[model samples]
Target: MPVPDAPVTGAHRETPEPPGGDRPSRLDPAIAARLRRTPDGLVAAVVRQHDSGEVLMVAWMDDEALHRTLTTGRATYWSRSRREYWVKGATSGHHQYVRSVALDCDGDAVLVSVDQVGAACHTGHRTCFFTELPVSSGEVAS
Candidate 1:
């Protein structure tokens, strides 16, 4: 089955226009080629819960992770700290089933809508970002 939210041919895949009418080109062949040529072409991902507006996770994507995510319709990420591939919710049963994937104007980041199961954090929290640092206070607290 085709992955949900995967871009279909003829669909409007244009990147959003920036302020002052400055808009980068969408993920065309040329841009895709350039991305492939980069040493770390993969970008950031924003994983949101499909039913709720809750953000389940934010992860980084490498080329392999992107490919796997597109092919499998599941969230896949490159673990920079671990130096390996991480299929979200794979081990913990907190899988994120992709609903859609969008690229930013510069193609440097991605937003993913997904059907999240269980918790998105290994720490048993619902989200990977469990702690919030007070911006004004500059204090780190969970």
Candidate 2:
């Protein structure tokens, strides 16, 4: 079935041209159609550990990637550099199984809760925030 030219809130109306075609029927038409993307065609997804509430990583998600994640029950993101869709744990043994997703007030950012297995950071760390930046007081956050 041909997807309708629905009205999308914030920014221009997406042509409903999801990368892999129409979004799965399981996803609400209104909610799935309302995804807001930057001019560069991306939104921010913040991944956090479901149990410990520790931040795992932040990644970009275009409309298609977001749909992929919602439909597949896995954390999927758009690779800005590589220009591709990547499913978490596709390559590495580390995988983030989506537990819940929360949209920010602006609806542009998302907080994804996941049952993470192995390391969340590609560098083999539990989280990507292992490094701390020094504050104006010349003291780093502990």
Candidate 3:
């Protein structure tokens, strides 16, 4: 378990601990209590198109990113590569307007349903998962 005062490694900005020092995060207490984060303090967020049920992308969210997404009704993510917080389509103009957010049963991942305005994939595809993976054809044993 991480210490309450330890800085989140990839967060864009670190929030100073309040005087009492018992609070583990700046995220809403209710939401924070449910999250099971990676060692780097991130949760997997699987974004999907609300109408088509097409999975758009998978992103990472720290507590702050999740909080921002919840409060703003926009998709926000913590970019591991960029080491920053990025609002979806902020640069590409392909926005994801959040419809709903759900935490998975294990509390390790979140499902983000959104109204995707344009291409969800950065490569101009509809979704990030465009390649088909072949499966072995086999009969089930009865």
Candidate 4:
């Protein structure tokens, strides 16, 4: 299926188009290339907290999600269970502002350093994985 043209947003929309009648928005070519390579497959993003260096979450990014994150300077992800692009903390108050973004060696994964406002987990924990299972005992503990 053909993808629709992405909607223009922010002050750029008010600016006049180039001589060509339409100007492409500022998105990293490398990121775009990675998205195109993946198609509908998974692209993992390792979400890290800026101050503590904690890995808050690992979310997937679709083309739209990656575009939104780059354009808005916020964290966005493609939710496999929901089957949609979801802006981080859109409904919740725990928004994540992008500090920096990087692609992995194979270009199939991403690392996003962010300023996480509140809990990254839905369960009110600071991180998604609240409890860890002990390998030796095979017991789950917080």
Give Cα-based local distance difference scores for all models. Answer: 0.64, 0.73, 0.78, 0.68
What's the CA error at residue 88 for candidate 4, in Å?
A: 1.1
lDDT for 52 (candidate 4): 81
TM-score (C-alpha) between model 2 and the true structure: 0.74
lDDT, candidate 4, equals 0.68
Query: Model 1 over residues 1-142: C-alpha lDDT tens digits?
Result: 2121222123232443222212232334543553422344457888888778788778887655676687789887765554456777655666788988877777667788898877776667778777888767576888
What is the C-alpha lDDT profile of model 3 across 32-110, one tens digit per residue?
A: 8898988777899999999889999899988888988898998988766655678887767778899999999989999
Q: How much is the lDDT of residue 100 in candidate 1?
A: 83
The C-alpha TM-scores of every prediction are 0.65, 0.74, 0.81, 0.70
- Off by more than 4 A, model 2: 1-28, 138-142
Candidate 1 local Cα displacement, residue 72, angstroms: 0.8
For residues 1-142, could you state the per-residue lDDT of candidate 2 as single tens digits? 2221121223232353345433233446676556676766677999999999999999988766776688788888766554556777776768889999888888789899999988888778889899998867676778
Error of 2 at 71 (Å): 1.6
In candidate 2, what residue range of length 10 has the lowest lDDT sum?
1-10
Compared with the true structure, model 1 gives a TM-score of 0.65
- Count of backbone collisions within predicted model 4: 0
Model 4 residue runs over 4 Å out of place are 1-29, 35-39, 137-142
lDDT winner between candidates 1 and 4: 4
